[model samples]
Target: MAEVLLVVGVVVAMFVAYNIGGSTTGPAFGPAVGAKAISKPVAAGLMGLFFFVGAWTIGRNVVTKLGTELVVDPGVFTLESSIAVLFFIGIALLVGNIFGVPASTSMTAVGAIAGLGLAGNVLDLAVMGEIVIWWVVSPIVGFWVSLIIGRYFYARFNRMVAMERSTGPLLDVDRSGPIPIPRVHETTNRRELVGTITVVAIGCLMAFSSGTSNIANAVAPLVGSGELAMDPAIILGGIAVTIGAFTIARRTLDTMGSDITELPLTAAIVVASVSSALVVFLSMLGIPASFVIIATMSIVGLGWGRATRPVTVPEAVRKEKAPPVTIDALAADEPGEELPPIGEEDPDKIPQASDLFNPATTARVVLMQNVVPAIATLGAYLTFRFVPIFGI
Candidate 1:
C-alpha cells in the first residue's frame, strides 16, 4: 500500500511539474523565440538545461523551506496528504490554462501546503508570514524598478538592444570534416548576432530563475513526507518540466509571443530581467516568489512610467496641466531615436491608459489569478480537515 501510494505521489508531482514548464516557458523564452532570436526547439532545450542547473543548486533551498520549515511538522506530508496537495495545485494549473491565464505555481503550491499544515495543526505562522511579506514586497519592487527604467533609461536600452534581422540564416552547418561545425552566416552582422545572443541569454536567465523558485512547487510535499530524497525528487521534477517545455510549451510560446500581450522586444527584455532577478533573490531566501504577479506589475509600471514622462515632477507639482495617462508613451519614441527632454514631447501622440488596457479585463485577470490559488487553499483545507479519506 505504501509503495502504491508513493507511486501515486510521484505521478501527481510530475503532473504539477509538467504544468509549471508549460506555463513558465513562455514567460522565459517567449520574447527570444518571438523575435526570431532562437528557434522554439533551441529555446526549449536551453530552458531545460538551465532549469536543471538552477534546480540542482539554489532550488534546494526553496524545497527545504516548503518541505520542512513552512510547517511545524514535516510528518504532516503523508503520501496520501501529499497527493491531495498536488491535486489541488494541478487543478489550479488546469484552470489557469483553460482561462488563458498563467497562474502562479508558487502561490498555488504554497497555499496547498499551508492548507495541509493548518488542517494538521502544524502550521508555522512565522515562516508563512515571512513568505507572505515577500510576496507583497517583491512585485512592488519589480514595478518600481521597471518604472524607473521605463521613465529614464528605457529609450537608451531599447536603442542598444534593438535589431533589424537581415535576410539569410543566422547559422550554417559546415560539413567540411567528420564532425559538422556551426558558424554564423556571413549575412548576419555583428549587431544582429549580438542582439540575438542577448535575447537568448536573457531567456536562459529567466528559465534559471523559474527553476530556482518553481521546482519546489512540484516535489516539496513528497520530499517533506520523506518518501523521496531531495536529490531524486529534484531530478524527477526537472525531467517532467523538460518534457513539458518540449511539448505543451509550443502553444504558450505562440500565445506569449503574439496574443496575450504585445510587449515590444525591448519591453519584454526589461520585464524579464527585472522579474527574474527578483525571483532569484527570493528563491535564495527559500521563498517561492510569484513570477506572474511580478511580471504583470512590471509591465504596468513600465507603461505607466513611460506615459507619465510627458509631465515633469516640478511641472506636475505646480499644477501645470499634464497630458492624460496613457501607455502609448511606450511607442511615442522609436528605438534609437533621440528622445526629447522630459515633459517636452507632444501630448498628441500619447493615448490614454484605457486605450492600451481595459480596466475591466485587467481586473478580471488579476482577480482570477488570486482566486485560483485561494481555491487551492480552501479546497485542500476542506479535504484534509473535514474528509476522513486522507487520514489527516
Candidate 2:
C-alpha cells in the first residue's frame, strides 16, 4: 500500500510539473516567438535547457521554502496532503489551459499549500500575509516599471530619428529614371552597443530567475514527504519542466504574445526583466508569487500604455460615406447599350463597421486573456479549500 501510494504521488507530481511548464514557458518564450526573433521549436528547446540549468543551480532555495518554510510545521504535509495539493494545482492549471489563460503555477501551489496547512492546523498567518502582499504588489510594480522603461526607450528612438532627419544629407530624386545610391560609413553607435548588451543580460537573468523560483512548485511536495532527496528532486523537477515547455506551452505562448498586447522586443525585454527581478526577490525572501500574472499584466499594461492612441479606421473606410457609383455618360443615352447588371454582391466583402470598431475585438480578447488566468488561480485556491470535504 505504501509503494502504491508513493507511485501515485509521483504521478501527481509529474502532472503538476507538466502544468507548470505549460503556464510558465508561455511567458518566458512568448515574446521572442511573437517578435519572430525565434521559432517556437527553438524557443522551447532553449527554455528546456535553461530551465534545467536553473533548477540545478539555484532552485534549491525555492524548493526548500515550498516544502518546509511556509507552514508552522513540516510534519503536517503527509503523502495525502501533498497529493491533495498537487491535485488542486493540477486542476487549476488544466482549467487555465482549457480557457486559454496563462495562470501562475506558483500561485496555485501557494494557495493549495495554504489551504492544506489551514486544514491540518499548521497555518502561519504571518507568512501567509506576506506572501499575499507580494502577490498584490509584484504585478503593479512590474507594470509601472515596464511602462517607464518602454516610454523612455520610445522617446530616445524618436529623438535619434529626428536628429538624423535634421542632418539633411543631399538626396537624389529622379523624375524619369532611377536615382543612384551613395555609400556611407557603417559604424555601430555607443547607444546601440549598450542597448544590445543590456537586453542580452536581462534575457539571461529572466531565464535563470524563472528556473530557480519555479523549482519549488514541482519538487517541494515530494521532498516534504521524504519521497525524494533535494538533489534528485531538483534534477527530476528540472527535466520534467523542460519537457513540459517543449510540448504544451505553445497555445499559452500565442495568447500572451498576440492576444493580450502586441509587444515589441524591447518592451518584452523590459517586462521580462522587471518580472524576473521581482520573482527572484520573492524567492530569496522565501515568499511565494505568481509569475504568469506578473509577467502578463506587465506586458499587457506596457503595450496598451505605449500605443500612440486607440486604433481608429481611416476616413476612407468609414461607414457614413456612400460607395461611389459610376454611370458611363454614353451608356446613359444609348438604350441599346445594355446596362451591366450590378456585379453579384460579393459575399466576402469586409464590413465597414467592423473595420471602424476593431478596437472592441481587441479589448475583448485582452479581457478574456486576463480573466482566464485569474479564474484559474481562484480555482486552485477553492479546490484545496474544499478538498477535505470533497475527498479528492
Candidate 3:
C-alpha cells in the first residue's frame, strides 16, 4: 500500500509540475515571444530547460515546505492523505485546462493540502492564514510594481524613438519600393555590439528568473512529504516542467502575450521582472502563489495605467449627415445612427488593432483568466471536503 501510494504521489506531482509549466511559461516568455525576440518553440524550450535548472537548485526549500511545513503536525500526512491532496490538485488543474484558464498549480496544491488538513482534523490556522495573506498581497504588489516599471520603460522607449526621429534617419534606406532595406553604410560596429549585449542580457535574465521562481511549484509537494529526497524530486520536477513548457505552454503564452496587452519589448521585460520578484518572494515565504495571476494582473495594470482617455461615441446621428441611409448602417449602428448606404463607407478608419489593448478589453481578458481559476480552486476545495464516498 505504501509503495502504491508513493507511485500515486509521484504521478500526481508530475501532473502538477506539468501544469505548472504550462501555466507559467507564458508569463515568463510571453512578452519576449510577443515582441518577436524569440520564436515560440525556442522560448518554450529555453523556459523548460531553465525551469528544470531552478527546480534542481534553489527549489528544495519550497518543496520542503509544501511537503511538510504548511500543516501543523507532520504525522497527519499519511500516504493516503498525500494521495488525496495530489488527487484534488490534479483534478483542479484538469478542470482549469479544460476551461482555457491558466490556473496556478501552486495555488491548487496549497488549497488541496489545506483541504486535506481540514478533512484530517489537523488544520493549521496560522500557516493557512499566512498563505492566504500572501496570495492576496503578492498579486497586488506585482501589479503595481509592473505598472510603475512598465510606465517608466515605455516613457524611455518613446523618448528614444523621438530622439532617433529628430536625429535624421538612424537607418539610411531608399524607400522607393514596397520592400525597404537599410543601406550597408548605415550599420555601425559600436551600435551592433551594444544591441547584441542588450539582447543577450535580457534573454539571460528572463530565462534565469523563470527557472528559479517556477521550481518551487514542481518540487514542493514531493519535498514536503519526505517520501522522496529533495534533490531527486527537484530533478524529476524540473524535467517534468521543462517537458510541459515545450509541449503545452505555447497556447497560454499566446493568450497572455497577445490577448492581455499590446506590450512593447521593454514593457514585457518589466512585467517579467516584477512577476519573477513576486514569485520568488512568495516562495521564500513558503507561500504558494499563482504566476498566471501575477503576470496577467501586471500586464492588465500596465494597460489600464496607460489608457489615459475613456472611449466615447457620439450621442446622436444626424440623418442627412449619416451619409446615404441604408440597411447596412442601420444594422451596424449601436442605438443612435439611423442608416447609411452599404457601399458608402468611411475611407479613413480607426484600426481594430489599436482597440485590442483598450482598457476594457484588457480588464475582461485578465478577469476571465483569473476568475476561472479561482472558481476551480473553490470547486476543488468543496469536492475534497464533502465528497466522502470517494474518500478524498
Candidate 4:
C-alpha cells in the first residue's frame, strides 16, 4: 500500500509540475517570441534546458526547506498525505488554467503543506514566517526597481534594446563535419545579433528563475515523505516541465502573442529581469517566492511610473520653458460658462494610461488568485484534523 501511494504521489507531483511549466513559459519567453528572436519551439527548448540546470544546481535547498523546515518534522509527510497535498496543488492549477487566472503555484503548494503541518500539530512558525516575509518583500523590491527604471531610464533603455530584423537567417549552420558549427549570417549586423541574443538570454534567465522557485512546489511533498530522493525528484519534475513546455506551451505562446496586455519589449525585459532575480535570490535561501505577484507588481510599477513622468524633452526652439497647456485653452467662444480649474478636468476626458490599471480590478484579481490555495489549505486542515485518514 505504501509503495502504491508513493507512485501515486510522484505522479501527482509530476502533473502539478507540468501545469506550472505551461503557465510560466508564456511569461518567460513572451518577449523573445514577441521580438521574433526565437520561435515557440526554440523558446520551449531553452526553457526546459535552463530550468533543468537551475533545479539541479539550486533547487535542492528548497526541497529541504519545504520538506523539513516548514514543519516540525519531515516524517509528517507520509506518502498518502503527500499525494493529498499534490492533489490540492493540481486542482488549483487546473482551476486557474480553466479560468485564465494566474494563480501562484508556489503559494498554493506552501499553503497545502502548511495546512497539513498545522493539522499534524507540527507547523514551524518561524520558518513559515520567514517565507511569508520574503514573499512580501520581493514584490515591493521588484516594483520599486522597475518604477525607477521606467520613470528615469525607460526611453534610453528602449532605444538601446530596439532590435531590427535583417533579411537573411540570424546564423547559418554547417553540419558537414562531425560537429555542427553556427556562424553569423552575412546580412545580420552586430547590433541585430546582439539584440537577438539579449532577448533570448532574458527568456532563459526567466526560466532558470522559475525552476529555482517552482521545482520545490512540484516534488517537495514526496521528498518530505522520503519516498523520493532530491536529485531524482528534481529530474522527474524537470521532465514534467519539459513535457509541458513542448506540448501545452505552444498554445500559451500563441495567446501571449495575441494578448493586448502583453508588455512591450523593453518593459518585459525590465519586469522579467527584476522579478526573476528576486525569485532566484529567494530560492537560494530556500524560500518559495511568488513570481506571479512580483511580475505583476513590477509591471504595474513600470506603467505607473511611465504614466506619471513629466515631459522632459526641450524642443529645438529657444532655451526657455514652454507654456503649459491648460483647460482654458479649450474654452468655448460662444458660451459664457466659466472654465473649470486647470486640475479639475473630467477624468473620463483625459486619456490617461493609469486608467487601465484599475486598483479595484487588480485587487480582485490578486484575491482571486489566492482562492484556490485558500481552499486547499482549509480542505487539508479539515481532512487531517477531523477525518480518520492515513492513520496520522
Candidate 5:
C-alpha cells in the first residue's frame, strides 16, 4: 500500500510540473517570441535547458524550505498528507489555467503544504512568517526598481534597445566548412543583432529564475514525505517540465505573447529582468517567491512611473490620483471583449494599455491571484483535519 501510494504521489507531482511548464513559458519567453527574436520551439528548448540548470543549482534552496524547513517536523509529511497537499496545488493550477487567471504556483504550493503542516501540528511560524515577509518585500522591491528605471532611464533605454529584425537571413551560411555552419557575418548589423540577442537573453534569464523558484513546488512534497530522494525527484520534475515546454506551450506563445496587457518590448524587458532577478534572489534564500505578483507590479510600476514623469508631486496628488478612464474603470459600462484601442476606433473602446495599470487595478489583479492559494489552504486544512488517510 505504501509503495502504491508512492507511485500515486510521484504521478501527481509530474502533473503539477506539467501544468507549471505550460503556464510559465508564456511569462518567460513571451517577449522573445513576441518580438520574433526566436521561434516557439527554440523558446521551449531554451526554457527547458535553463530551467534544469536552475533547478540543479540554485533551486535547491527553495526545495529545502518546502521539503523540510517549513514544518516543525519533517515526519509530518506522510505519503497520504503529501498527496493531499499536491492535489490542492494541482487543482489551483488547473483552475487558474482554464479560467485565464494567472495564479502564483509557488504561493499555492506553499499554502497547501503549510495547511498540511498546520493541521498536523507541525507548522513552523518563523519559517512561514519569513516566507510571507519576503513575498511582500520582493514585489515592493521590484516595483521601486522598475519605477526608478521608468522615471529616469526608460527613454534612454528604449532608444538604445530599439531593435528591428533585418529582412535578410540573420546568419550567413559558410559552405566552405566540411559541415555548413551558419554564423553572424558582415551582413549582420551590429546594433540590430545586439537588440535581438538582448531580448532572447532576457528570456533565458526569466526561464532560469522560474526554475529557481518553481521546481520545489512540483517535487517538494514527495521529497518531504521520504517517498523520493531530492535528486531523483528534481530529475523527474525537470523531465515533466521539459515535456510541457515542447508540447503545450504553443498556444500561450501566441496569446500571452502579446496579450496579458499588451506590453511593449522595452517594458517587457524591464519587467522581466526586474521580476526574474527578484525571484532568483528570494529562491536563493529558500523562499517560494510569487513571480506573477512581482512581475505584474513591475509592469504597473513601469507604466505609472513613465506616465507620471512629467508631473510634480503636487500635480500627481491633484491630477494623477483621479480615476483615469481605463478599461477596468469602464469594463462594466462596456459590453463585450471586442473593445478597440483608446484612440483608433469609437470613443467607448477600452483605454490604452498604458492607462490600464492604475494602482487599483494592479492591486486587484494581485489580490485576485491569491484566491487560488487561499482555496488550496482551506481545502488542505479541512482534508487533513478530517480525512482518515492522514492517520490522525
Candidate 6:
C-alpha cells in the first residue's frame, strides 16, 4: 500500500512538472521563435538544457525551502497529504487555463503547501511571511526598474537593439567538407545576426530562471514526505518538464510568441530581462518568485514611465502639469532619430492612450492571477482540515 501510494504521489508530481514545462516554454522562447531566429525544436532543446542546469544548481535552495523549511514539522507532508497538495496545485493550473490566464505555478504550489501546514498546525509563519513579502516586493521592484529604463533609456536601447530580419535563411550549412561548416547567409547582416543571437540567448536565460524557481513547485511535496530523495525527484521533474517542452509547449509557443509580437521587440526584451533576473535572485534565496506578476508589473511600469515622459519627476510630484497618457511609449523609434531631453519631448507627438495598457484590463489580469493561488490555498486547507480520508 505504501509503495502504491508513493507511486501515486510521484505521478501527480510529474503532472505538475509537465504543466510547468508547457506553460513556461513559450515565455522563454517565444521571442526567438516569433522572430524566426530559431525553430520550435531548437527552442525546446535549449529550454530543456538550461532548465536542467538551473534545476541542478540554484533550484535546490528552493526545493529545500518548500520541502523542509516552510513548515514547523516536515512530517506533516505524509504521502497522502502530499498527494492532496499536488491535486490542489493541479486544479489551480486547470482553473487558470480554463479562464485563459496562465497561473503562477510557484504561488499556487506554495499556497497548497502552506494550506497543508496550516491544517496540521505546523505552519511556519516566519518562513511563509518572508515568502509572501518577497512576492509583493519583487514585482514592485521589477516595475520601478523597468519604469526607469523605459523613462530614460528606452529610446537609446531601442536604437541599439532593434533589428528587422532580412529576407532569406540566417545561416547556411555547408556539408561539402568532412566536417560540416555553418556560415551566415548573404542576406543576414552583422546587426541582424547579433540581434538574433541576443533573442535566443535571452530565451535561454528565461528558461534557466524558470527552472530555478519552478522545479521545486513540481517535486517539493514528494520530497517533503521523505518518500522521494531530492536528487531523483528533481531529475524526474526535469524529465517531465522536458517532455512538456516538446509536446504541449508548442501551443504556448504560438500564444506567447503572438503576444510578444504585439509588444515591441525591445520592450519585450526589457521586460523579460528584468523579470527573469528578479526570479533568479529570489530563487537563490529559496523563494518561489512569480514571474507572471513581475513581468506584468514590469510591462505596466515600462508603459507608465514612457507615457509620463513629458513631465519630469519633480514636476509631476509638484503638480506642475498633467502629462498625457499615450501608447507611444511602446512605439519603436527609428535608429538615430534625434529626440529632445526627457521633459522637453513634445506631448503632441505622442498619440493618445490606447487599450494597450488599460487600467481595467490590467486590474482584471492581476485579479485573475490571484484567484488561482487563493483557490489552491483554500481548497487544500479545507480538505486537509475537514476531510477524514487524508488522515492529516
Highest-TM-score candidate: 6
Ordering by lDDT:
6, 1, 5, 4, 2, 3
**By descending TM-score, how would the candidates be arranged?**
6, 1, 5, 4, 3, 2
Better of 2 and 6 by lDDT: 6
Per-residue lDDT tens digits for candidate 6, residues 254-347, read: 9877877567888888899999999999999999998989998999888777777788889989989776544555673677898789789877
Task: Pull out the clashing pairs in model 3.
Answer: 63-220, 67-224, 67-225, 68-224, 326-340
Off by over 4 Å in 6: 324-326
Residue 119 lDDT in candidate 4: 93
Clashing pairs in 6: none
State each model's CA lDDT, in order: 0.86, 0.61, 0.58, 0.78, 0.80, 0.88
Query: What is the per-residue lDDT of model 2 for residues 282-302, given as tens digits with 9 covering 90 to 100?
Result: 777766566666776676555
Q: Using TM-score as the measure, name the better of candidate 3 and candidate 6.
A: 6
- Residue-pair clashes, model 2: 0
What would the per-residue lDDT of candidate 1 be over residues 166-221, giving only the tens digit for each residue?
89989999999999999999998876887788888899999999999999999999
Top candidate by lDDT: 6
Candidate 1 residue spans exceeding 4 A from truth: 177-179, 317-327, 349-354
Better of 2 and 3 by lDDT: 2
Model 6 worst lDDT run, 10 consecutive residues: 323-332
Writing each residue's lDDT as its tens digit, candidate 3 over 144-240 gives 7655543334344332321111223323676888999655334334343333234334544555555555555545555666677777777777777
How many residue-pair clashes does candidate 3 contain?
5
RMSD of each: 1.9, 14.7, 11.1, 8.3, 6.6, 1.4
- How far does residue 242 in candidate 2 sit from its true spot (Å)? 1.5
lDDT (Cα, tens digit) per residue for candidate 4, span 96-215: 777767778888889999899989989999999998888778889988887777656665566666667899889999899999999998999876887788878888999998899899
lDDT score at residue 169, model 2, on the 0-100 scale: 22
Q: What is the lDDT of candidate 3?
A: 0.58
